[model samples]
Target chain A: MALLNKDGSRLDGRGVTDLRPLKITAGVLNRAAGSCLIEWGRNKVLAAVYGPHEVFPKHLTNPRRALINARYIMAPFSSQEEHGRSGPNRRSIEISKVARHVFENVVFTERFPKTMIDVHMEVLQSDGGTRVSAITAASVALADAGIPMRDLVCGVSVGRVDGKLVVDLDKYEDNLGESDVPVVISPRTKELLLFQLDGLLSKKEVSEGLDMIFEAANVIREKQVQALADKFKDVDSGDLQ
Target chain B: MILEEIKEDYIKELLKQKKRIDGRALDAYREIKITKDFIQNAEGSAIAEVGGTKVLAGVKFDIMTPFADRPDEGVVMFGSEFSPIAHPDFNAGPPDENSIELARVVDRGIRSAESIDVKSLFLEEGKVLGVFVDLYILDHSGNLIDTAGLAAMSALKNTKIPKVEDGKIIRNEFTGKLKLVREVAVTTFEKIDGVIIADANSEEEVASEGRMSLSTSSDGFVCSAQKSGKAGFSKQELMDLIDLSSEKSKELLRHI
Candidate 1:
């Protein structure tokens, strides 16, 4: 089946540059110091922040800066047919490492020396593009926790479907698509935090995908800020719950 | 683990007056939330939350050689991880006793109840499908066993077996949902100052003397039961606890 029709419209009835519907909610959990829920199309992700507290195991702690421990987990029932394993599988472990790297650049980790800032991203439901969404949610969660940051991070994936470059490929498109480029950037400084590419792509296609993702990141950054604002709106009005 | 004397005494005193630290009745459970299909990569997955406690269960199926003893039946293996991020007390290492106990309890319940129809999973005499249920403890408020059990059962119920042809599994082609023979639910009660409380939080769990987990099937039969902690339960107390568990299981099974 053609992923995109002759008129440049994709299978999900979106234009080549169109992104999926996005929803972001902050401070959804009571246990975590800060939390955010992000729903990008069929993907549902929750990000929780704990610490800036003492780092356990002691030896892993850094002397000059705090550490960012980021974990990304996909729930067993989040997919269509197979149940995911619960622990840090190879994929999750790698995502955690990369996500931690992304946050270290945005978060002011040096302020809390020898401590750790733990960010947990749980994918409650997924339909592709979870890794990027997880980063988006995690950044909001850190902000929700009132952590100082140089800039908020936002991410999106752009890919090629049926020889047509598209933004925010869904589950169906991700499977059949030829190339996917995921990018995470600091909206304020426009500094790249994460950049990864998979599948085959030409130089021109890579540039086009990167341009789309960079633009999409700005839009997502706005939503992230708004979500945090909504959560603290009551506090701003002097009505503390 | 060191229990704060003041906190322990506070819980004990509250139970005496038929009150809980969290303002729940002795038999009342915390809020229970179950979300299914949480992972897109797994065949079946669910997240079960009991108050602040959260457990994620994912079911994955793989084709493998059946055990020599049970060649005609499929296999179900249960694994659990108590991640350090879940709680401060949980350290990162190999599976500990608590995790092992939790996995065994959850495994026994599903196995004894025959929740999944393993016979139908038999693809051939030597080759059968293996169902792997992995439970991830994300947040640990208390009562992880019950939450993990609930999550596992819900995930299994949501599982869809993929199509297999000539010993090769088709990822995109699903034959149908896994055949479930019965629905199972687990209810845990902690004995605090001789009073039984359902769904104990971390504070209440520390003060409790004994803990009992009862797994009940929809057919109104107690499939599995496990008791732990330093204290013991009387015969009368056990019977009462089982009744309480049976009633609570009905409420939990509704989520499935």
Candidate 2:
């Protein structure tokens, strides 16, 4: 079968199960209550949190819990191929739903009733794992906004390329790779909120992919927490200058 | 003109006590944030955040045959478009007149100041050109002229010529800096309540009846000027602003 590479190698110079370089930053936006920009290899995502305030439209309000409204946008010039439009698209809408679901379960929505929190994410560049990167960045932005949450949500994508499993595929690998599995889990509770597979994968391959993604999520979650600590650790009042 | 009335009221306040909502004096400008070489893919790029306004510009080089008339010199083109994604008011389509005016004014400032060495851009006399400058406006808060001009200069200064090997585009491993000829700085003055203020924001821009954007090089010379207000300034006021722009240019060019 041509499923595996002749030399047993992925398209990129990566091993069977290796994650891409990951970096996350919080409080990048000045106006937003909370904001962050995360870079996973060449992919870059910026997430911002706006509310937890009173709901604007009466019809959209829920008295028992807060509502989560999220939108994902990709910049027009970000890709080599022309991105369709200047605004959100079908794929962005799907990612928005998945991202909203992941954060809705983790955030303490019951604490702020009759209010809606707007989380908007823009992908400046896209490799694979944009959804997971959104989830990872959204949670940090929420925390940066001073919103209470049960635990930090960590997102990671694992995929099978050339019959071998890989973690956090970059754009080059993602577009040409065979299959991908993205998992968003609460690292503290170990509860998976979203599981999605794109392209194709066998049942056994899916299981192995999830295991590698979750293990890597733990390492990423620690880094996410440390970034928060480092941002607010010991800045004097005069440091704003 | 939903904001016209609000702007007029604010202008009145500025005339009374020379104060702005952000608390800058009549002639004072907001804090400026200048960052260079931000984008990795482009040959050179810069992000200049003045107050709440942000502009990111990048320079990309492509080999092209020189124009028939200007065979001895390379070509330089500038474009500015406000993305609708950045604001609700920005609409889709080709750039409106406002956007065109902004690009031309900034382009004139650079050209008049001769910040770029056009002669050096010609790789082979009457053959191919070595450089091109592409200015992009990522966001528009207010006073786009100054922000765009600063970003264009920063991006050009950070640019490096690519290495051409055997008529093929090979990566340039050797590193060197571009040779900048002059430094030009733009100062946008909004005429509010019969007074002039430096670096107006979106709100202040709407409040003022007119605006005067001036660009000056580091050598105390005026490069370009744009007047867009209904009300005209007196001769003394015009001269005073030119002097102010020259001093401001010196201060800003040093930081670059």
Candidate 3:
């Protein structure tokens, strides 16, 4: 059950700062205004964007700005654990709330006042860092939908396993690690959109871990940009490059 | 929060002058009061009050099959209800996002700090004691996270594991105190008009742009944290908040 090998490599042979295989595909669904699929490590997440439409129930409307509804749900068969009932459980509800907040800052809702934008994230498979993975995909989906954004959001994490600091933890490391800090960052704005910590860590570890988080975030952001760039290429955007 | 009653302009203006609506300094918290073990029926109970926010926490136990991944560890579940009477924004229905987040945040603090020796609660091969901490928001003036956390931690601190006979617990009989490995507390800070203030009241909460809650254990380590709202903090601002929470936790731990 040792998380690390004697040479300091992870169980999967990743370096301390290495991320799992990252693959993001934009515009996977035709019906959604925007959509994307991301495969991070062992996590398979699909995100779709809808609306900028009239608010339902008529009571949840915000006059000054459009409402952003972010819903994160894990499929019943997504995890290795016992089959769970589908829909918003307490964990997903919390994640949805935080994810919703992330889009609130990213999107310029004031332009489309008295409307609602729906961002749906479905976890087809999960290992760990699902929330971060979901949010990262949702951000790309929002852009694909042509929603105006202040900046793109990037999600990443850092953790301590076997008394060593590492980036982009896997399921095994997360479940057994001493601590994990998942963060969502606005690369251009220099703002931390989402920050959540699980387990205990000293001040020094926290500060040091954040450094790793931000660095890993930059790498993830590049992949996101590349994904979107490829999507544009598919659309026949005239390239002068 | 009652949006109509929120004094966004007034609170922001006051904070700019380094003064709070309640006349406290930037780092000051509203008066906190914790009353423990007042509910006699439950194994443990406490009511935490911060300014006008009032939350009650009660601890109960049951025997359940442990998760397959960790058969030797007990379980601690946190539930919360934001009663319609607690705040105007609350509704009488299933728990909403705010309530769920509150319970989880407090739960993370306690669970991460190892407040309960999960292994010690292992009863047999497949069964373990499950501790349930139910938090009821009786009133809302703001800072519910801190209040609920106080109540839960205090309730668990005073809990007594009931003695079991033939796999059934006696009504009033008890073993000893539930051993808490460490104490945990959450300190929430709000950024209003670019000013970072601690323990925001209901009005300030409505006016704030962003919020972050840091949970620290008694041993000076941050056990858990959650950053919420639309706005965000810079690297330095977050670092400062982490340090501030660490220092503020010492004060809250004293009350528990």
Candidate 4:
């Protein structure tokens, strides 16, 4: 199957550098202290934040600073073909651990000693680039939860499809394509938070993919800020109305 | 829980005039949105939203041995996961009773309605296909049973039977769409202050005295019914609820 058309457009009829349709909605869930719903192509991810509260299992608590407990879960129904078993599987566990590490760098954990901030990212629908989307949404949720952070984390996945470097890979492109590189960076400090490369890529390709991802991340960062603004826009105007 | 008491009183006062806190009528439901093929990795997937409550259902297939008693039949299994993201009260652990009950209720609705032709999934005497329907509660404002049930049915309806060659399942190859016999929809009714309401939010759910869910087919047959909570309903009330559910099922079925 051709991952790209003869003209270098993807199977989804987008240019190699193009991204899937992106929409981010913040504060969608009422129960969570902070919440965001991200629709990136067919991927539907929800991120929620709770606490700055006490950490259970005393041994796991860090007395000197707050601990970041991040979980990334793929709903069994989130996929198109297979029903994933519920709970933290090996893949989710790894993702959770890495996500926690990524957020730890941004969140000022030392401010809330002996407390924990829980970040939960639920993938209701999965296409591709879910991990990156989850991180993007989780950062916004953290900010919405009133957690002070060095900067918001923005992310994007760049992949080599049909031997061409593409900015964002959808399910088909990600699976059928040759290589994938997902990266997350703090838009403010220009610091890397998460970076992973899967499949084959030359040194030049990796450099090009990073450049593409960085550019795409800036666009994503704008959307994230706008989503947060949209969420508070109502409240901001409520006082005047 | 004390906040529930205050909200319960307010809900009861609102019920006196047949009004809901969200401004819905006594039998009114929140706006429902269903998007099929929401996930790309599953054979079929759908997201169902009823008000603030959201549920995603995905259908997957695997090859398995047929039951000794039912050699020519396939299997349909239902599982539910209530993620902590949906509500603060939900924990990350094994499926609790609420999850199991929700899955069973949704499973019963599909199974009793004969929504999928299980016998068609039988590949050979010993080999059969097993269908798994997984529901994930992404948001839990209230009325999860009904929303999850609808999502499950929708995802199942959207399912395609995967191709199998020489007992090996091909991941990317699909044979054809699954044979579906009927369309099912579940409607849940909650009793508060002696009045029945539809699509209750979390606040209303806490205030609710009794809850009843009825799954109806497109042909107007009640496939399954479940009742929960401490309160009970009168015979007339039960019949009225059935009538209301059947009517509402028609509206929901349109979305499917």
TM-score of every prediction relative to native: 0.52, 0.50, 0.97, 0.52
Candidate with the larger DockQ of 3 and 4: 3
Q: What is the CAPRI rating of model 3's predicted complex?
A: high
**Which of the numbered candidates is closest to the native, going by highest DockQ?**
3
Measured over the true interface residues after superposition, the C-alpha RMSD of each candidate is 25.4, 28.9, 0.8, 25.6
- Give per-residue CA lDDT, model 4, range B123-152, as digits (tens): 987999999999999999899998998898
Candidate 3 true-interface contact recovery:
0.89
Candidates' DockQ values? 0.01, 0.01, 0.86, 0.01
Task: Give per-residue lDDT, candidate 3, residue B177.
Answer: 89
Better of 3 and 4 by lDDT: 3
Q: Which RMSD values do the candidates have, in order?
A: 21.3, 22.0, 1.8, 22.2
What fraction of the true interface does each of the listed models get right, in terms of native contacts kept?
A: 0.00, 0.00, 0.89, 0.00
Docking class of 2: incorrect
* Per-residue lDDT over A144-237 for candidate 1, one digit per residue giving the tens place of the 0 to 100 score: 9999988888888888788788899898888777756666767675544665455444445655666787778778988998999999887756
Better of 2 and 4 by TM-score: 4
C-alpha positional error of residue B243 in candidate 1 after TM-score superposition, expressed in Å = 1.2
Task: Spell out the clash pairs found in candidate 4.
Answer: A79-B42, A80-B41, A80-B42, A80-B43, A81-B41, A81-B42, A81-B43
Each model's number of backbone clashes? 22, 1, 0, 7
Best by lDDT: 3
